[model samples]
Target chain A: MGAIKKFMYINRTAPYGSIYSLEGLEVALIGAAFDQDVSMAFVDDGVFQLKKGQDTSKSGMKNFSLAYSALGDYDITKLYVEKESLQARGLTVEDLMPLTYEDQDDDYQEKPSIRVVDSEQLADIIAEQDVLLNY
Target chain B: MLHTVNKSPFQKNSFDTSLRLSRKGSDILLIEDAVYAALKDSAIAKTVKQAVTTHSIYVLEPDLMARGLQPARLIKGIQIVGYEGFVELAVKNDKVQSWL
Candidate 1:
């Protein structure tokens, strides 16, 4: 077989504070469209993308929680959230996307099936990728 | 691995680590506040030299412009890249890690 092209997606922003998370999602979507073996990881503020019940309406930003749910349809599974981020915010993985598979549609798996990764695991996983994109 | 340094070379640990790890398989990308290192005579610029001697490094043009500076005269061998180039880095490197 030829070289396996693995792409890692790094998100480093809060959901409502800036365009970083939304843009990250768009870039990941585009990457999956091109058929890359992709993995998503969140660090620092990036963990906000996986938080549950985000109401950006008060801030006048479009809620993108649904977009995250759709990542499975594109086979963009294996999402990881930094454990430190959740701890810093006094939250646990349970407060984030609660399910990994969604029954909403058969075309994709459920949302919130993300794995919680500590910094060391994150570094190890990152070292294994062939391609890495950040948002 | 390609390391993305978006913070000031002094502020975040990424810059220093990226440089130390700048072997044949790794690169350092200056993004966000990290682009501050691209300025002439800045603290970070001075430190970047050590990394350049061993590895490839670059700065994001948009970030530099956002800070109202040009990389034309500041860097000796550092390259400039657009957002698309950032994407290209992801496509080419074995791994991409962001130091935020």
Candidate 2:
């Protein structure tokens, strides 16, 4: 690691409908490999990116939503879902996929990674980042 | 703020909207298909050229190359940046607003 910079990847678009969410995830993974402190924010329609039971068989698109769970494996475990975005869409955390990963530093125990936060908290996170990539 | 637009200007209003909303001195980065707007003779290019006086405009070099757009074909005064430059711009700005 040269210099670890705080990096935040913001997702505001829905997955499948556009390439932003998928491409945003790609950047998050790449940021992790660079040894930067990586965090993800799901806002607006982006909360759908974490929705459970996504089947793209008919759409002929690869269901990359499952890749959200793999974020923990990459040590990019900070996933923030905006509370207001979900409420506005009439969705709750239950509607999202339960994302967890084994904590290698803690006896390899499985633990949840997603954090449901308010817009204020999300703003703080955004302001604290050294770099923010919005998609 | 760092305003990034990845949609093609011809197909989307992101560039026009961002240009209107961005404060003077803010930076604009055109990436992905949005790189097409940097074509020297395009209408979007004319818009961007006008925007350059108030905002710093940049085109993602890799995306331009991926779309087979030569640097010489880009409008004058727009800077071309790589992924590293993308990171640098994000760090340089206080916040980022992606114009979807």
Alpha carbon lDDT at B94, candidate 2: 84
Report the lDDT of model 2 for residue A98. Answer: 91
Candidate 2, chain A: TM-score against the reference = 0.94
Alpha-carbon TM-score of each model against the true structure: 0.52, 0.57
lDDT of 1 by residue, A11-80 (tens): 9765544577788899888878777678899886576567665554323446677688777777777898
Q: Which runs of model 2 end up more than 4 angstroms from their true locations?
A: B1-100
lDDT of 2 at B93: 91
In order, the TM-score of chain B in each prediction is: 0.84, 0.96
* Worst lDDT 10-window in candidate 2 chain A: A52-61
Model 2, B22-62: lDDT tens per residue? 99988999986677677665445567789888889999876
Measured with C-alpha atoms, the lDDT of residue A52 in candidate 1 is 65
Evaluated at residue A58, the lDDT of candidate 1 is 28
lDDT of 2 by residue, A79-124 (tens): 8999987765445788688998787789999888789999998999
Clashing pairs for predicted structure model 1, backbone only: A100-A113, A101-A110, A102-A110, A129-B94, A130-B94, B7-B34
Model 1 C-alpha lDDT per residue in residues B6-37, reported as the tens digit of each score = 65543357677766665653777887667656
